[model samples]
Target: MSVPAHPRVTDVIETPVAAPARPRHRADIEGLRAVAAVLIAVYHIWFGTVSGGVDVFLLLTGFLITGSLVRAMERDGRIAFGAFWTKLVKRLFPAGAVVLGAVLVMTYLFFPRSQWMTVIDDVRAAVLYYGNWHLAAGSVDYMADNSAASAAQHFWSLAVQGQFYLLWPVLITLAGLVAVRLGVRVRRVAFAAVGIVFVVSLAYSLWITAVEPVWAYFDTGARLWELALGGMLALVVHRVDLPGTLRMIAGWLGLAGLVSCGLVIGDSLPYPGFASLWPTVAALLVILAGAGEAANGRFSANRLLGVRPLTWLGGHAYTLFLWHWPVLIVYLELTERVRPSLTGGLMVLASSFAAALFTTRVIEGSVNRVTKRHRAPSWSLAAGVIFIVPVLAAGSLWAHSIDQDRRLRLELSSNPLAYPGAAVHLNPELAAGLPDLPIHPDTTTVARETIDQTRSCNAVVEDTEVVSCEFGDPGSDYTIAMVGSSHVRHWFQAMRTLADQHGWRLVTMTKNACQFSSEEQVYRGEVYTECTAWNADVMLELAELTPDAVFTLASLTDRKEDEHVPTGFVDRWRLLDGMGVDVIAIRDTPRFDFPVPECIDRNGRDECSSPKAESMAEVPPFKDLPNVPHNTRFLDLTDSLCEDGVCHGVIGNQLVYYDTDHLSYAFSRSLAVVMEPQLLEAVGQAVPKGEPTLVDAAMTLHESAHS
Candidate 1:
């Protein structure tokens, strides 16, 4: 193939040199795909780390697709965007649809009903090729119902690739158009556009990964730079004809770096940031080395990578990637284990490979043959519609059923006689026949009952700005501020009942996974800088408002099977006492390593309670702390929440803690009976203004759910 010539250089009059042409076929690149797939599976299953294999795949997609688009644009004046997209849909959709269908069945069989709605949303997101954004949004939103990792979660990377395919060609076509008008080489313009993307996306990736690594992990913008690096390489790879010896050395060095990236970085650094350059640049080196034949074939990285087994694995790599995660997740769910044993992990790997081989040959092969016979875009479009519509329809129906079930459960809670909640602990009559009744806020729907499920009031994982929600009497003269993390916010239902009856305004200053403390806190092994800033803003807000009473948690279990009041909590209370604001410090609830509701649902509630001695100290730690604020009054309702030595999953037929830690809103409302008198005594208000009953509270909860 004759290469495109650069326009004449005015600085010196010389004949235009022809640019090197990219090869049409590279067996070594196919082998590289096999390596990436293996790394991804191994890291996910055995190491619990990101292998940087996804980054390598992103780079390869950028390189190969850009090369294909540039060639097409050079041959024809413009890219056939419709034909290109249709072909992509035909090639990718069939395998994706098959995997989704299999995942849906696996979820129904092995996963609980409560998790169905989340996985269904994942399915829809995958179908629309927006799974990355969907997962990113949910990952950061602490109160989101979709917190549990779904079987289809791995679709996020494929979704990123699909989005790249949709956008990259258009960018190159536009660059080519501008190049024609400007009378410059198209490759120069294309390279410039890709270079800009590389710099901008890399900067954004570094910023977001540092501040909100969880979201950055699945963010398309954070990952675009990896792809752009590959695009840049494709544009110039042919122009650099390196010496064979240099190519051999670069090849080996790049492969070694690529292999070591996961082991060295392994779950330590926030990803897709500058750290990602290790794997992506290594991939670039490999491609640069293999762009031409080596002087010594035996030692060339390309020669080793191009072995028949690797190339074969590369042929099935796409399906292999899709099959692995769902298989691992289903295996874990069935075994009731967090992670698989070594032998089990090997079994998972073998099963994934087998499934991938079968899927690639049967589903993908059939689609490929049909598309080959009928090359028209319409045929491809029809193929895509055939594969996608059923999954969407099934997901929609499943989501609707979940909503209906939740509404039914809420209605059941409206009757206190059936769902007495914490009241039964005090009233023996309410406890009668409770063992035979159905649990309200059904275990399946309990996880979704977070404060943010109904309203977006608290700051999310990455946000530093203060977001407050006002409940109870907004116009009341007396104010009761609920301040802290979700722990403090979880008690809002009980506080709301008190606020309404006593004519006191209720305000919440809360952030997800952040407590109201002055000391630095660590979350997920990183300094929660956003939480620190949020705590500062909250303190300033409290000083300005200086409410009559400031409500917050007095102690924490610290997830270490022990409870205590940290020195930071005492400092904040003292500051509040200085402001003449009375502090209503409530004891924090028990922290669990596993989801309580899920445990209760899987095994009967009788088998699910944790021993009180295992979760809390014999006495409240805050009561013994030195330098305790004189104005701060403590409330211990642990007896009302846990029975005799055990923290029960269900109290009075109402599920207590929703997930592992936060109390269910329905159960929290029921605790008003125990909470009201303590709150009144602490604030020096008349005891129990209107004496609100649990029945009234239940009705209020039903109304709130509708609202």
Candidate 2:
């Protein structure tokens, strides 16, 4: 392919050029590197409290490296793929290995055995370059209901970059080769191809951000354009030159933009799409300002950046990146807190810096020197394979183990309320009279009185198809509706038993994370957009049915510790009251403060075998002071579950909680003895004086169908 002549000289030689006069190392570029590094650290430590600054770093990386790669390819007829791979390894692996090794050792010492298994899994993923996908699948949920996973969660970004690095060079090479075959200038073709990919990827990123923001943020498909922006810069390098004043302006503007991106773009922005352009564009401007004859300018090439400390940091940036996150994670894990104190943060930072320096000096320098001396492509390839293979194997094994453990737990903890044996054992009082009560052959008929009352009182009914008023046996007179988030849904097994025994049709309206609130536009997926519109529509249906009582549970973890009532609970109470439906606020059970799987894996069945009394004593009862003026009654089973101020792990020989916060179906069903009276009191009803009938038996069921 014909190459265009430009004023800038190509710096390549047929043979190794004497490492060309090491141009005065520009302080500004180092400063910019320092800035990128700092932004990432701050964002993760505090602002992951809010936005993803790491994505900005990715964009900056892509722009800088892509520009360098394209310039190299344009200057030389071909890119030395072997050399490129070697440089990448030298840049990334030494520091990465140190971090991974440290995490593994620390994880063994401090983390529970169950968490160790996850560490093994993550390490494997980290090595194999698929950590992002693993994390995405895990979701590492940080919502009120779900807590964040591993401190190593930040490694997911590194994995994304690794994957990109693996594929990008190949893509660039293919594009170059294709351009050479055709009658196009290699630089122009490379530039055009990168530009096209950037636009397409950016478009895809936007679309995916709207539809599947979580995946979009993690997926390479959505992130490639950020890197392409840099490649585009490399191709057009010789054509554009900024004068001194403009260079200064661009440098300042770029720095400002980068900082602003972190400050302004909070967690609310669907990340790594158009919004990411702010940081990326800013990065590009800085890179451009540092290019050409003006590369030695004051702003970018200043002495501040050239100082020993900044230069040392810039040189070890890759190492520092690897070491920082795990240190932060380990610190948080030991403390069991999200926001570390300033002193703690500083300690973590100091430790990470120390580790980075040691790893770079001892490990990275040695590896680079050894690899450069060997210069054997076969050895490099073999080493790469060796490094990656165990990671892949370990990841697969860990994934399998996790799946197996989940299945085993599920099997052992299957909903006991659904088991006939458990039901018989759970309520001997009800079971004793079950044989004497005559079973009604049919009870499908809806009472006319109930139908009339529902139609007159129900205000939110939008569809007749879902809202049905049906009569039970002539003796049956009650109705019940189940409502709330996924946790409420977990109670369906018990709800079904109660509904069937009482001869009342069950009306269920539930959505995951959708608190049954009147407020619209809760955040969903990746964006702060409206929740599933159908959820609101379903609530309207439930309101129309106007059941005798609405049953739902307040999430224990969802409540801020200082606040006794969950925010969702407050919102939901108002909506239910407005609908004129009586509310049964089932108090949430306690969650194990630590990771459940870690405890289980380490302790085996004994991990979950604690008596309910012992468990309840450790976790205090929620003091529910009603915030609403409506007819709400507080139910307290804390005293019943806890004897002598201590809650037992097992209640009636069944595990009280299956995982951390969720009540075991068997345990929940057993609670019928303690709960039945409170339920009656809450509904302002008296229990029949005679032997318990099917209607009375129905009141005893307390298992959850939704979690």
Candidate 3:
């Protein structure tokens, strides 16, 4: 061969072929972002369903960010944590800060003063990138104000994404190092690591989603598998070279599945659990179909996704995501409608698009330009500092002011003359001489007055255990058990007062939105499993404790055209009678379509009052029950709760209710004077005829307030 006229260099030397460079940008992914943002906004506006767009966004984030992180770890053997975080903050925070500032301003202008604190808290949570956890906690909280969605509620997804960005790089770096030590391929190890997270998180998600769906909806741990699924795909995308026909089929199927997911699942099912797989898997299929040579297929989704409109929408997707929720919520508030009208929805969509365009071009463009000019990580860090300081400072200041106001209101409410509460109801003479004092437990603090903060023994919505608390003469031989939903809980102030005076040990077994009943109950259209289980456990506990009497609500009121003793209540009463337990059943209080305190704030007390007939029947509804337990005693406080055929929001210079149906603690405390005698008689305690009455005893407090 050497003798063949000195071999040519090209024939003798074989040059090594270089691997194809990874794509710097993906238009198809951007188009998918557009689809997700639009779906979220539209579904929230009109569908009243969880559109799975949030889940899609989560998966996309993992796909978009994980590959780069893994590659960087493999290339450098370590991640530039500071530089990466700085760049991420620079990219995400500026627009977020602007949105927070806007939300604060809008809350002050458009929302009720009572709602300001919630918005402030949400803003703080969003700023700290813990909004998802905050929302998760609030979802399970009995006292959380959720009359309306907070403007920054959508930031929960952003907060999750922000958290993922912080942790994923470190995880990839760790995996890369571990791979080197184990003599394994980086991609293989990374995929396995992601698989472990996916399995564990998915299992947890399924369990929590079934057990406590409301809480699970916003829990980050329950949502991690969605992101890990994308990470797994990212690790192996280079190898996913599907047949052209298969890819084309996947592309169309994914697009269809993404569009129809919310319609199929709706809000009826617990979400971001196994249900979320529909959208997330669809997103993956689309991503896979567009990978490598598959994207070149004639009927590929790549052609449709690369169209100018979708790409343009994707460019503004982040800002659109930021702007749409606030716009929709504010619109709903302004319109005073729970959901937007057809025309209103269109207007909201247009306004959101316009605002997003402006924000992207002005706010985001300016921040991006500055960050680009200063390529150093330190400049990005400085920009981050600038972005965060104002939000923290402003939120802290606003919260401080509200706290001060709350403290002052709480202090003022302690003076009986300033807040006569139910004293006017106890003695009509006091009502005649009532001064025009400011409402007790001011509108902003009213919702918090349902019960004392120190007393947190009631089982939450998710808990099934028989959580009981003892108050007033816990060491007494005499025992009385208070049981029911929040209806019975709101009467705690009065019950505790009577228990202490009468030397009875008062025990409370209560759950929010759950009455003491054996009948199968439905809450928010799902089986009230916790309530049913709690009721069963409570019944067993009651058998062991053998309380002298069980105090609970006697009737149900819709605050509309209905007020009746439910058959379930009668059944429970009969069961207690069979157990040799006496039952003291108070008639249910009036419910309202609006918060009494908020109504009183917007419209004076008299104007906010409704006809007593709206909530009460001509006769006590329990009296008409077909089967009556001999040991059951019925008591009606309708006279004290309402007067002159009207149920007032504020009576005796006191807000009657903390919320729509829950009585204020101050009002409930004042009712102790009237409730004492009836409660004593029901428990077989002697009610002296000649001695100073409870009404007379309560007058002393009013007299002291005057002095």
lDDT of 3 by residue, 233-292 (tens): 888887787888888888889988999998998865677677899999999989988887
Question: What ranking of all candidate models by TM-score puts the best one first?
Answer: 1, 3, 2
| Per-residue lDDT of model 1, residues 502-539, tens digit only | 77898888888898898999887678899999988898
Pick by TM-score: 1 or 2, better one: 1
The deviation in Å at residue 516 for candidate 2 is 4.8
Tens-digit per-residue lDDT, 66-132, candidate 2: 6556556656645667777766665665556556766767876776544655577678777666888
Off by over 4 Å in 3: 1-20, 140-147, 294-299, 449-455, 559-561, 624-627, 687-693, 700-707
Descending-lDDT candidate ranking: 1, 3, 2
Q: Which runs of model 1 end up more than 4 angstroms from their true locations? A: 1-22, 140-148, 293-296, 453-455, 687-707
Clashes of each: 0, 36, 0
lDDT of each: 0.81, 0.58, 0.81
